[model samples]
Target: MTDSAAEARPPSIDSSRPHPARRYNYWLGGKDHFAADRESGDQIAAVMPSIRTAALANRAFLGRAARHIALQGVRQFLDIGTGIPAPGNTHEIVQAVDPRARIVYVDNDPLVLTHARALMSGTPGTITYLDADLRDPAAILDHKDLHALLDLTEPVGLLLVAVLHFVRDDEDPDGVVATLLDRLPAGSWVAASHATWEHTPAEVVAELQKSNRDGRFVPRDGDRFRALFDSRVQIAEPGVVSVADWHNDDPGRAPAADVMCNALVGRKR
Candidate 1:
């Protein structure tokens, strides 16, 4: 294969175990997933039929939220838990509005890092990828790469899309969000989407829980999810609604009722 072709190919990911990033890629109709990821996705979809719809909805919300923040004149971004390279990624969506946009993407998964490095080849804006976990907000905030691209005094867009659910309560997910936001300037924004069980059925919830036996996903209620933003940050308009209903540019593609994810954008006070 040509160099470009090889770059276009998905990384050699492990197929023995299901990974959240790969499974999420599969749901978003990307080619970067393995059989194990597909099987896990299929099992989740079998119980919660709207899993794919939810993924699409969450992706759409990311685009809208990024564009909104970009228009608000935030030229720097720190996107945590960035999954595999897919259509409408954070840099693509934001840089389309402002070519000068600088973005820092953080993800602990190696396969995601490989694909992300490949995607950075022809990217127009200043984009850097970091192999880091969200559980360690201090490392992310103090990283040399992050500081090189983003100025702490300037307004930045802190994106935590569909990743915080992986952070268990024991790790203090809410505190983590607060800590990251605290490191940013007052005008900076925090945009996030988290999975919830509010709209799911009891049996389906149980099955979903069983599917995530390793405790990677921790679905929260609407209030608990909102609490992640805390009182320091002021919630933006259309506060913490379903991902399908969060500032959707394409309302026709609204996800199904069972999508079960809440989204919100907040500005630091």
Candidate 2:
């Protein structure tokens, strides 16, 4: 059995060890992390220079996907692994298209939970926050707060942007995606931006991974990452391309060099 004391103490955050989400937040120019996250962010950036650009691209892709789905008339959103809020949050983007959009943001971070509640309150209508981890999809799905706010019988957009990279391979990532996607109805969509290193040379990926002590995440090759969508959903056009290559507003901006991630949008059949 897990030690209750260890679970209770929750470790003083060490402020030295690198955390992926916090580091990414730092890269995105968010002011919600400590010195350690900045240090780790710098370390990763030094090795993989496109880290910052990739983060920006990931955020942009989320906005584009939201707009695309909203235009298609899917108004309900189940945003798991919802990170710190910035411009173009799901509800804000969708509500612009249809004001009655219902959004539920889920995250395990206490800090994110606080920010989410603020974001929801500031938004126009029907917004909920569920303090749940992506690893615990069952707890997230079972959260009464969401069912009360969102309708499962209707098409819901499952947003997993830039978050699945935190789930290590041994955690059965494919199974995790399947479980979440399986629960939603026929027309629900699952969209994500996952970290990848295919464009980056192997040496760079190796150095960055080694520098983080393998903490950034398990680098899933294109094939393995695509396996997460297997047999469950119909991937949208331009399937699983580098974030810069996916439907972009500016093509002149050179494709983010050696992108460490890829953007994907899929619809459940």
In order, the Cα lDDT scores of the candidates are: 0.86, 0.78
lDDT leader: 1
The predictions' CA RMSDs to the true structure, in order, are 3.2, 5.1
Which residue ranges in model 1 land beyond 4 Å of their true spot?
1-13, 249-256
Model 2's TM-score against the true structure: 0.90
lDDT of 2 by residue, 1-269 (tens): 01233343235434445456567688898876667678778887888777788788888888888888888889899888777787778888899999999999988666566577778777745898888788888888888998998888889999998888888777878878988988899988878888777767778867876765656376666677788886898999889787777787685644745566777888897
Residues 186-232 of candidate 1: C-alpha lDDT, one tens digit per residue: 99998999989887778878888889887878988889988888687
Tell me how far the alpha carbon of residue 141 in candidate 2 is from the true structure, in angstroms, after superposition. 0.5
**Clash totals in order:** 0, 1
Tell me the deviation in Å of residue 155 in model 2.
0.6
Candidate 2, lDDT over the whole model: 0.78
